[model samples]
Target: MNFNQKELVKSTVPILKTNGTDLTKYFYRRMFKDHPELKNIFNMSNQASGKQQHALAGAVLAYAEHIENPEVLINVLKSIGNKHVSLNISPEQYDIVGFHLISSIKEVLGDTATDDLIEAWTQAYNELAQIMISIEEGLYQSNLKKSGGWKGWRAFIIADIVEESSEVKSFYLKPKDQDLIGDYLPGQYLSVKLFVPELGHEQVRQYSLSSAFNPEYYRISVKKEQNNSNSPDGIVSNLLHGKDKGDEIWVSAPSGVFHTSFATDHPLVLISGGIGITPLLSMLETNKNSLQENPTVWVHSCRNEKVHAFKEHINVLNKDSQWLTTHVFYETLSEKENTSVKEGRIDLSELKDEVLIDNAKYYICGPEVFIKVQYNSLINLGVAQEDILYEEFGPQLLHFN
Candidate 1:
């Protein structure tokens, strides 16, 4: 964008800070009203909870703040690009989003939206859109070139479902074509699209691949999100839980930036809270199977054993793998059966001797608040910022800086 356009977008920073969510909320409503089919690609549950709008608002504000140097936002953009690929977002969709976004800006800004201002934002949006499209194109091409990979959604049948816990179940999905499945990094996630009868539209949700790469099937451990006072029940997850074996669901190829590298033999620390253990399980398993005998630690926190998934599997791994160390914390323990298990929430300060391996890397996954707490704890323990990586379950909301 030109200097004038950059200046204009930057000038809107103050307004964006105050009315950003309103603008994005308006944009979504406007877009969905005109093109109802797009609803299939979005998570309406997050829309209802205002999370999608808030996340978009934050992203827009950040873009405006850094309009002069978009390169700085490349990492953030790549993260979003990974998510877009998982949802099978296409380049044509960008035109629709741009139209609605520009329209919302003008409508919300009222008479203050002059022609030059509109044009400026148009150029800015286009520039940012191009960057995203380019990034997504690269991701799409990479997936296509991979063995057993394809663009867009592919049909996958639930070959089997295993109960991991009272609330969590693992769905073993195999390609409907009976072809080999593409391999993915241990921490990557794939999107599942399902039709929701009550909502009268399809919903897409991403779940981490809970197992190491498999040629026959991809396993995703899902936690049934029960309705509560704070939020509505998870539509897709509940629908998945109700699905029978052999039922078909549309799945996108695995895509995510928060994956560990098997290239290095560095000691690794994997920490998780509640249902966040899904991705970490893959990492632990992959590490166990790797030729390198890197010392690895698994630290998990959950309510109790009843809701804890993969307990026996982890125990067997712990027992068999000399390089693997395990630690568990239950908010309320039913019984003191294991010496490695503790009572109450995760306290890194207490696990200093266990988790504070020299030159080890830390990977955390959990709810927004839980991730923040663990991130801060790691910082307090003097872990380098660059050494710690995290993946939030929903919209990116955690800001460590």
Candidate 2:
């Protein structure tokens, strides 16, 4: 962008900081109203809860803050790109988003939104959208070139289902065309696009692969999101729960940056709260199957054994593994459950220093607050920020200190 454009964009940083939320909330309302068809692709549940608005607000604020040096935000771009790829986001869709976004800004800013300022954001939006488009194109190409990969959404048949817990179940999905699927990195997620009869829309949702990479099939364990006070009930997850074996569902190729398959000699520490264990379980199984000498520890927190998915599976994996050990915390024990389990939230301090190797890399997943608390706790325990990693369930609300 030209100097005048960059200056104008930078000048809006303060305004963004103060009115980001209100602006994005308005943006979504305007976009959905003008383009209600997008409701099929966007998560209405998140939209209703204001989660997507919050995410867009943070993204815009960050963009305005670093408009002159967006290269510093490349990592953020990659994360967003990964998600876009999972949802089969096409480059053309950016035009729709950009148009609505620009309109939203003008509508929200009212008299203060000068033509030049609006023009600056228009250029800024296009530039950022191009970068995302390029990244997503590369991702799509890589996925298609893989042995068992296809672009966009592919039909998959549910071959089997395994009930993991009272709340979670694992669905084994195989390609209907009998094509090969690429070997995805552990901790990555696949987006499932299913037609929800109730919503009368095809909804897309990402579920972490719960098993090791398989060429013929993918295993995804889904937790039925029970509706309560904090949030609206899950639309897609509940739809998935009702799906029967042999039914077909459309799924995008795997995409994510939170995997641990990259070369790292450091010990591995996998921490999870509640159903966040899905992807971490894949990483654990991948590492174990690789037969590497890396020491691995699984620390999980859940309501209790009844709701704890993978309890038996984990025990079976732990039976003879010399390098693997598990520490579990249950909020309460069941009548028939054993007593060695501790009560309350996850307390990493309880583990010995040896278990948490000084140079061990930590991969944490869970709810937003749970992951944030664990991240800070790990930092306080002397774990370097670089050594700590997290997988957010949605647009990141937490900031690193």
Candidate 3:
């Protein structure tokens, strides 16, 4: 905890980086061996994907590198906290993770990881973990402090349900506890947990706040994930498929940092693909009343019109607001079916033409591949790197260059 001790741990960061991957591998092995119950919490498919492992290694090394200045890691820590919260991981679970992580480092580093080094890392992990715990606790308290928002997964009665598409449905939820619901910034997401009888324990998934922040209710649009019978059915989506208007579902407070604040009056451009339209829609709806004269453009891509969610609401907004513009691109629509709309994925040419301003603030949310392609195109098309913001759906990964 002292300066010298902190420096020692910071110096050991490079040594750990050399063994970071191995340490994470050892840590997971030990963790899963000790607590097999956690196997369900993490995405085993992602584990097989290898990219998640590399991302975790990079994150751990970065934390160890910045151990002395914990403030420098606040953003990273907050993201991790949100992910953990969505997974229903608790503070006690963190203790288990920290133990395995620290032990793995000690075991891998051998003599270089002296008792002093161990003590320093122990103190550092405790401090970092506590910061994460406190941050999450604050979020939990804030959620529960409101009239409608309460602690721990409370039931929200589905007041209204509208079919957005053949596969997706929009559910307007009202807290069963009170008439008032907590207000949230545009572009935030809520974690919904369901106790699926088939999946055994409760499974959690984050759905973006499709509806604008309103005092009376909250809304989320869910696309039911269907696949071949050979594959396992999606736990949460399938459960939502059978639910009716009167059914109750567990909900968490809106939590995400990818929100639009009243920071600037710069022209706004939002780009999305498929179901990624949820958060961006919230942002657009929230800013509908802005007095600023800046124009807002939304460019969203989907397979076709049948699968598009919230088309009617967006159409109504388009009719009412001249400053708001929306361009929908479908990958598989006949010219006769949709002659006015462009037909293809988002690319540099479309973005250059549709995005009115070259230097406007940009917000992106979509599949990883789509994000990567569009991000590169944006930078290549004269968009400033700093002005571009993105929110990945799950398990944090650095944005592609």
Candidate 4:
């Protein structure tokens, strides 16, 4: 964009700060009204919860704030690009979004929407759209070049479903064509699209792959989200839970940037809370067979043993691998267990000697609050900011200084 356009976008920072969410909410409503078919690609549950709006508002605000130098936002853009690619977003869809977004801005601004302001925003939005399209296209091409990978969605059959816990179940999926599946990073996730009879539309949700790379199949562990007063039921998750063996579902190739490298010999610390263990389980499984002498520690927290998925599997791993150490913390203990079990929330202070090794890398996965608490605790314990990586299950809303 030109200098004037950049300045104009930067000038809207104050307005975006004050009414960003409202603007995004209006934009989404207008877009959905005009392009109803797009509902199949977006997560309606997040829309109803206002999470999509807030996430978009924050992203837009950040873009405007850094309008003068968008290069700095490349990492953020790449992350979003991965998500868009996983949802099978196309370049043509950006045009529709741009139209509705610009219209929403003009409609919401009313008399203040001068010709110059609208023109400036149009140019700015077009530039950003092009950038995103380019990123997504590159991602699409990368996936296509991978072995056994294809663009867009592919049909997969649920070969089996195992009850991992009271709330969590593992779905073993294989390609409907009975062909070999592509390899994905241990911590990456795949998008699953399902038609919800209750919503009268298709909903797409990304679930972390819970197992190591396998050419035959992919496994995803899903925790059913029960309906509550604060939020509606997880439409896609509930629908998936009700699905029977041999049911077919549409799945996108795995995509994410939150994976770790098993090529290194550094000590690794994997921490998770509740169902967040899904991705971390993949990391642990992939790293367990490594011939390196580096140690790996698995720390998990949940309500109790009944809801703790993969307890036996983890126990077997702990017993067989001398390089693996395990710890479990329960919010409320039902009975006295072994040395690995403790009663309370996760406290890094208690495991300092085990986790504070030299050049140790920390990977945390959980809710936003849990991530923040653990991140801050790690910082307080003298871990470098760059050494700690975390992944939140939902939108990328967490900001750290």
Summarize candidate 1's per-residue lDDT along 1-401 as a digit string, tens digits.
Answer: 78887899999999999999999999999999999999998888788889989999998999999998889889889999999999988889999999999999999999999999999999999999999999999999999999999888999999999999999999999999998788999899999998889988888999999998878899999999999987778888889999999999999999998998654479999999998999988888787677785899988999888999999999998898899888899988765556567988899988888989899989999888888889999999999998899999888866553
lDDT value for model 1: 0.91
- What lDDT score is found at residue 226 in candidate 2? 77
Full candidate order by TM-score, most accurate first: 1, 4, 2, 3
Could you tell me how far off, in angstroms, the CA of residue 120 lies in candidate 1 after the best superposition? Answer: 1.0
| Each model's backbone clash number | 0, 2, 0, 0
lDDT of 2 by residue, 1-401 (tens): 89999999999898888888899988888888888888878887777878889888998888888888988888888888999898878888899999999999999899999999999999999999988899899999999888877788999999999999999999999999987877899899999998878888878888999888877699999999878987666888888899999999998888998888833477899999989999999988888788784788888999988899999889888887888888889988776777767778886766756455867889999999889888888888788898888988877676673
Candidate 1 matches the true fold with a TM-score of: 0.98
Off by over 4 Å in 2: 229-232, 262-264, 352-355
Q: RMSD (Cα, Å) of candidate 2? A: 1.5
lDDT (CA) per prediction:
0.91, 0.87, 0.78, 0.89
Candidate order by lDDT, decreasing, is 1, 4, 2, 3
Q: For residues 1-401, could you state the per-residue lDDT of candidate 4 as single tens digits? A: 78887888889899999999999999999999998999888888778878889989988888899888888888788888999999999888889999999999999999988888899899988889989999999989998999988888999999999999999999999999887788888789999998878778888999999998888899999999998887777788888999999999999999998887655568889999999999999988888755663689989999998899999999998999898898899998865666568999999988888889888889999998999999999999999998898888988887662
What's model 3's TM-score? 0.86
Q: TM-score winner among the candidates?
A: 1
Which TM-score value belongs to model 4? Answer: 0.97
1-401, model 3: which lDDT tens digit per residue?
Answer: 88987788779776666877777777888887998778666665455555556678877777778776778777777777766665556889878988898898888888777898888889888887889899888777776787566555667999998898778888899888766677777888888876667646656678899877878889998888786765555667778878999898888777777888633377889999888898988888777755563578988888898898887888898888888888888998875775757888877565577784845889998888888887888888878787888887766676342
Score residue 387 of candidate 3 by CA lDDT. 86
lDDT of 4 at 327: 87
